[model samples]
Target: MGSPAERYTYPSPLAGFENAPPLPDEKNEDGKSFKNPPRDILSEAYTTFPEPLENGRRGAFDVHIYYFSSNKAYAKELWERIRREFPELRIYRFWDHPVGPHPVAMFEVNIFTPAQFGAFIPWLAIYRGPLSVLIHPNTVEGGEGVSHMDVERRNHSQRAIWMGERIPLDLDLFYAMGS
Candidate 1:
């Protein structure tokens, strides 16, 4: 029999799949295949809003950090550290239970500018300490009157980045907010 390494050197199920026909490229005018596309093209698109801070607005995005009440001590310590470290940013008090459309207790952190966002995200990534964060932008412009449920769905399902265990949210509460 062959050596152990040689014996187990079998091809993966998708070994030859990479060279197969690629999916249709939506951005291309001719709907051509995206075979061996550039690395940038394969990556997900980043979210951007149009002229968010044009008129002296405070912010364009709000980030929420979710934690269970059972770990109140750790959550409080984390919250205090954030407040102390980033005094310029706005941080809200901790909620013990569900608030707004959120199904679990969470605190809010408001980021007013791209500079603040750039500084805050990386810091949180390293120091979050057993917390799940949900980051969403404030897309409401003019008087569009978009419901909170729409925002929550877009954030939790598609846009928001999760740092830890993603908890289920009560999207229905967003609809009830208008009542």
Candidate 2:
């Protein structure tokens, strides 16, 4: 094993793009670039999503609604309702086992815009029924390529916005990767 102070490194995925043009200079008065930059000539129109974090630090928040595999019937019904009701939102297929950072079988809903979030969360708050929901903002604090799952687990109860029964997550996967 390496020393605690030893650093780990991986090869660059964009090794050939060493001479790529530098990012455009900031246009804002503060000299900082925003995630959703001001509208430009190329793209004059776009949807404005609320920045989950201040200073445009993060993009969006992920809302995962978890249901036991055994409760597939009810979960399916609810999932369909969600689909029909929110056709414009991005919803993923339900997984029987833990996938991504989730510790239980769950279907994911990506809330890109704050308006969507405002509309959806209230409905979920009252209508989720028996399902447990895990909502976390997509922010990277430590470094790039670090999974939010690690940060979630560290502050599992505190960081996440949980709605129901909190299941134990297989956090080993995240720890192993960091090692």
Clashes found in each candidate (C-alpha, N, C closer than 3 A): 0, 0
Query: lDDT per residue, candidate 1, 25-135, as tens digits?
Result: 455555664444455343221333344222246456677888886676888888899899999888999898888667888898888766677789999999888888888
Q: Which digits, one per residue and each the tens of the lDDT, describe model 2 over residues 1-179?
A: 34322433434766655987665655666667534443335421134542223224333667888888677778888889989999877888989887955777888887766667778999999888888888766644567765555455443333568888776666566677656
Q: Give candidate 2's whole-model lDDT.
A: 0.67
Which residue segments of model 1 deviate by more than 4 Å?
1-58, 142-157, 177-179
Poorest lDDT segment (10 consecutive residues) of candidate 1: 43-52
TM-score of each: 0.62, 0.60
RMSD of every candidate to native, in Å, equals 14.5, 11.1
lDDT of 1 at 83: 94
